[model samples]
Target: MAKKARVRDYDQFIVRLPPGMRDRIKDKAERAGMSMNEAIVWCLEREFPAPVTLEDRLEELATMVSMLTDSKDTYSGVVHLIAEIEETLDAIGTKGGIPADTKFSDMVRERLDYWREIELDSWRDRNESPFDDANWTSVEEPPEGDPFPNLPDDEMKKD
Candidate 1:
């Protein structure tokens, strides 16, 4: 049990957070045997840490801004690339035809399939291909001799 403090007036504030965050916070508070207000206070204390110095805070803010800027730049680049690709494809379509002459698409698709098949079989040795011993050559060896002349298997074994 703890002593209760009386308050003359309390300030009320409303904020919207991502869905399920509030529910998760409430669940955590309930598990910790504390009220939602107490849990929120604790969480805020942890989340909003005290910076050692103004410079440290400023550096953190700068890093956050840089990250945001980088994200925006990357998104813009991707959008540009997609637009360029679409334009190129549209140009190709216009140069060719809408349905692409049926035979052309079919031939292109068949060629692509044939290329894929070739890639798939690139590492394989076909039955028709002879096993050429081009690099097969035996190395000269020394005369046969006892590898372990000083040691015996019975002596090496431990009881």
Candidate 2:
């Protein structure tokens, strides 16, 4: 039986390097336990990574804000934390400089508006709804009638 020929999976490209670069690449490749082509590809991938989008950053910030808001701390503490976060975001915007198409402040204001809407909805749910029973009692003791009358007394006893 004849052996099958190996297929080349990738296209070839001719790259011209400066003097001594080829030897350096060969040495580095050997040290890394990879072929020259693999080393070059790895280097290129490391140097030119995918860029982060503004949407991704906004989502990250939203997640952080949600976490801050959801903390069990006091309202004042939550407000202070949010203020610090806003200041940090402002500093980042100042450092990076605003883009021509979209301002960082505009994005922040949009997010704030969304948060305000959520808070308003929550407040309305708590205060304005007729179905909300603020005086509802906790179930520390069992009801007058046993929910599971058929269950054994031993099973119903608290530890």
Q: Would you estimate the TM-scores of all the predictions?
A: 0.25, 0.34
List per-prediction Cα lDDT, in the order shown: 0.56, 0.67
Best by lDDT: 2
Could you say which candidate leads in TM-score? 2
Q: After superposition, how far is residue 89 of candidate 2 from its true place, in Å?
A: 6.8
What tens digits encode model 2's per-residue C-alpha lDDT throughout 1-159? 457655485667899999999999999999999999989999888997555445555566577667866777656665665675465455544535322233666676678769878988997887785633454454454446666545578988843
lDDT of 1 by residue, 1-159 (tens): 446756545455687879999899899999999998889878887987543332343355456545656685755554454454333333333533232344544554566568657755873544334433343343533235744334566865643
Q: Give candidates' CA RMSD values in order.
A: 23.8, 16.7
Q: In model 1, how large is the Cα lDDT of residue 16?
A: 87
